[model samples]
Target: MSYIPPHKRQLKDPVSPSPFPDSLATKVMKNTDFKSSSVKVNIAYSRDAIFKWFLIGSKGISDEVPPSIKLVPVSSDSSDSRYGEKSFVLMNTNVEKENVIAEESEEEERTRWMLIAEKVEKDLVVAYEQAKKGMQDHHLSDNAKLRLVARFGKILFRRIHAGPVTEYWQAKSSNRTFCTDVPTSFIQNIKSKAIPSHEFCIDLEKEVYVVQISHYTRPHSTIICKCTVKEDGSLSMYKAELNPLRHLVVDVSCIDKNLDMRFMLAGKRKMFTLTEKERSNIQRMLDSVTVDSTVKGGLTWPHGKPPSENGYTIFEVCHVRATTYKNKTLRLRVRETNGYSERFGTWEVERGVTLILQDINTKLQEQNIERGCVLEMLRDALGTIWDFLHCDASLT
Candidate 1:
């Protein structure tokens, strides 16, 4: 009768099998309206095992890997570097000016940050230790939640945290990592597709849609995945198929207090909802200044009022634009936008949209498009995203 089972039986180690009346597999059949009862009993305990074995403190959890991996949302913490690395450059500039007064060259200060990679390595080593504590302690592997944490770890591991590890982990790009032991049999039916890096983590509270398409190597064909988190804590996968002929386009938007901003196509995922404080900070950002989508997708946008005089204001911070595909493998992109399509004051955004439209149509005219080749492209995108942002830790 109770949604949760009695705690007495499961209290042995707080992670032992619960004396529940209905197993998760049984409940899943009942809840999903499936007719089969011949399901795994471990489903009921998979979430628990993940929590106890991989998510809590390291004191009372097993270090061994569990059968099921949970995906928990690692919400952005109250703490994040405000200015990112750009702030350091500005500080160095000021310091260099003072150093010049005292007798140091600007080049010296510029080169000073080159060593930051070494320090970041120290931080990464420390972070990995701290990150594993939650997993080693709790064993919570839902796969439908806590994805951000896993990816945060990846970004740290591959990029900012320590620069780059030895080729034992990866080669060439900071976005790639090679795992030698994974067997294809365990992950059968998995195929490659392309998806957009835009609108990543969209509607995190309700869904996790990504775009996908069949894989193509020559940079003409790309695909993406679109996944949603179901009410039962399961994931529904989707994909975005690229029209190599259709020319997938991406546009990043942000403002510059310094006016000198640069961002590579580092990586992206579907945009999810933020915590209360993040929402607040985002609101403040919307109020204070104007942020523009550098890519001319020709978006009409509505600007919000500044918090300088008025109270807090709400704003639309996400958007989507998936391409129509002839294949089942989809090319999806969930772009995070600050109401670019609605914020245009008097400037016409159609011009920008036309540009992208032209690119797609132009490619089509060039006869450079193909279909049903998403496996490799999708694999690469998945690999890129997974290596850069995914970890078995999403099983939180």
Candidate 2:
């Protein structure tokens, strides 16, 4: 009778119950064509609402939705029901593929660095061999020899700074040792509380002497002073070299006791007695050491382990060939850890001191050589050249 909509007419007959049961009603609603509805609403929103309702009914309704279930908008076309599901599957597949690509790129980068490091190591070894041969050649002038040695030093310096090739030599010579230790003590002061500084000198001659002094000293500190024996037989200083020690590889022994201490600097042995204070200090450092026999240095520790109030010591035995120092024979050395000391103090210090010593030693040796004697000149020249080139610069 009245101009009522078809939806309103259906609702007006509230007194009549539906013939379908609850489960059947849900199935019929799911199968219903939303395009046939008289009410106009967002098609996508409506589909999402229906899906959410079905999920709630199956899983039991709650105030908050479950985390695992996600609602997404669907297309207006009722026939394409599986479109949203296909899109979600494609998105997941794309993410997995992207992750795989990223992983592959990272692996490739690491492999590239490894290859670069290997090349650097090979180049260093070749350069060293060439320099060694060139220095030995009598035909090559002093300038030519210096240039060759300098080129080798430059290569070594550059490789050391290069991030990829640092510490390459340690891995190559992990098993090599160039050190020998003999149990011996100083002749005098076998059991003395007070240790004198002059006792640490090994006299090469009255004019030329090799002395063991503290590694840390002022740049202008006088190491070797030229003195004249006066008429009264008193030594009078005339000339002095502010910085005399260069390219010196020191070997330390008698660590167990301070009664008689020994050190080998530039292949010359010096002996002395450590004072009570020095002995106690060294003893404290050596107490809490953790030893590893497998490593080249036979010592391992956490990187940048700071010194404690009690003191800290890391002992190592190193081979001369494995070190930057160009000593002829295989020998073992022990020394105190310095600022450059990393996990292995002996290895790190040996490598680090090379550049510093070379920069100074090359200049000093060139100035000190006399012009006349050919054999003596060659000997001195070869010795300095060997020190420059005989370094473990492998990058493996």
Candidate 3:
């Protein structure tokens, strides 16, 4: 007698049969087109499930994308409890083909940016080490050290195409990075050059050509001041001691007009209108003063308020993958919301969603999601919605 599987036995007892009907199962078996390897079926996953699975899948797979699974909202009747009006789903199917292609292109772009950033970081690190070695070995002056740093910063700024970064020393020491245009080294270099000397020639008759100091009060105010340089080298502008030359930062440049020499002072305050008939003279004068001070030194250079830094490393795998996944999910939802974009405008919806996304990002950041805690926090933030309709064993 041929052995028969227990499931195929004809004995009818108090047995828990599979949910799928025999006929459907038979059809599924017979259908040649329903190849399991290529056929993709849509299935809904709870937010918690998605977070868990994504984390696991990402870690497990090497250069392999997660299997295509469509995530829909958990049905209202599926569970006893319900939560928010907005349920997040991970639906990759609803996105248009063109949009998918665009996402792929974006992925490529991210990869390129990451590669470039990595190279920049390595180059900067080498440069920084070399500068430190030079300072240690050659006993380079503080000014020379700063100049080396400035040169390094210039390379970074030119290549990154982003805002200035804070000092590499600070960034490296703190084990953190920022995204800003102003390199700390560049600022330090300027400060090193602009050390102020309080010694002012006490000649009250010295004529110091001044620029209009009231541009804020009057736009296009080209009013020039013919003033006597005070004993303290400050110009008396309505009793306000405007230190135009001796105590100013090295950010002077000719702006707006050929005659207008715009320069920011040590404290980031501006006072403008020293000029000559030839614009070249004004440029040369600015350059000369800055060079003289930088070379000869002056009083302690005041620090400018630091530029804000909020940039992150682009090469972190965890960050990039998380960002990519979030973007994909966001795109899918955004497209769903704009289904009425053709018939009715999506202005209102788009505005509302922008706020929502901002809030979500804030929350995500608050979680302090490192690689270890990322999946856990994500799962918690996105509560579970149990799917009960289709059991794997019953389907089989």
Candidate 4:
């Protein structure tokens, strides 16, 4: 008998109609172990219909293989030259786990960034929806709605570009345009929360002349006490009181060589820079006023005290002794040390002082006392008294 390999074995006078060799039955039963005979069949120059059917049959058989078997692609140029013909490479069962884990981590990072971008876009859509509903509830007409929406779109554009990632925020405040056409949804990928919000006064008015020390402009203080003359032949004193002095800009244009100063006061959702003449007058008023060194906070006694031969005097109350007087009206001892010695004069703060202090506390809270500069705190303290009373006010 002639010798024959197990895979090439054939039978004559077959008992079954099926043409599949007997060895193929054993190969299919133990699917984990594949033989060369299973893959070495002639596939070149096959008919189109036959090749299609062959692929369909192969797919069904491949399902029996383990899922962990990776089908990595082989370089076509290298494989064709080295192996005559090759397409995919079967990854080794014992391949390192670290490489697979690293690849999985990289894919996860890409997915996370995509998710963040999608979330920002969704938030922008929700904001617009809310605005639309609000306008509808207000019974805005169709034309009004269109105009408001157009304006709101501009606000949204500035808001989106205000993010830390974009360079648009670096533009000067005045130069910023309200007619921008950028859409909020386009900023989906930006980290908007990183931008800082600038703070300014709420009720700040312009052309209000007040005094401030010229630390940079001049060695001496100048008080700007210009008054606005009314049509009724009455004079209205320029009031810079109640303005947050932290955002105040003095002499930005550098116009005055001696003591040029400017005040950046707030308006409705905006700010107004004072004129050069207005700033100069305010600086003169600030320079004229003098306070004692012992006082952490003080202001001129505005209600009852008259201006003396020296200047407008500043006073501060000792809160510890405010209610010591048995009378319903308390004689609160106040320190009068503007120009005189610490105990040179005795000033009284009555029930009116209580009201004044209450108002001061409120204004201080609004200005955020902890973060206030010395000049700003002094401005608020002096302003609280200045606006409350109008006696012997002569910083001019």
* Candidate 2 wrongly placed segments (more than 4 Å): 1-244, 247-274, 295-297, 301-340, 343-371, 374-376, 379-396
Query: Per-residue lDDT tens digits of candidate 1, residues 173-235?
Result: 222111111112211111122222322222222223332222122232223334443454322
Q: All candidates' lDDT scores?
A: 0.22, 0.23, 0.19, 0.22
Of the two candidates 1 and 3, the one with more favorable lDDT, higher being better, is 1
Better of 2 and 3 by TM-score: 2
Tens digit of lDDT per residue, candidate 4, span 1-396? 332211122111100011111223234323312112211211111011000000001011121323333333334332311113322322324345335434554334333322322212222223324434443565532322110000000100111123231122122220111111112221111112101111111222222212221222322222222334345422244533211111111111100010111111111111123456655544343343333224322323223342222232222122211211111211111111112212224322211121112222233223223423423433443332222121211111
- Candidates in order, TM-scores: namely 0.21, 0.21, 0.16, 0.14
Q: Put down candidate 2 lDDT per residue, 1-396, tens digits, no spaces.
A: 222211111110000011112233355444434343222211111111111111111112222323332212112221111111111000011234334434554334333323322222223233333443443453423323221121110100001121121132112211111111111121112112111211222212222111111212222232222333344423343432222121111111111111111111121111123345644543333333334435443333345352232232322222122222222221112222212223222232121111112322233235333323423322343333222222211110
For candidate 4, report its TM-score: 0.14
Between prediction 1 and prediction 2, the one with superior lDDT is: 2
Query: What TM-score does structure 2 among the candidates reach?
Result: 0.21
Q: How far out, in Å, is residue 315 in model 4? A: 13
Tens-digit lDDT track for model 3 on 299-386?
A: 1111311111121000100000001112211210011011111111111111000001122223332323343343332232121100
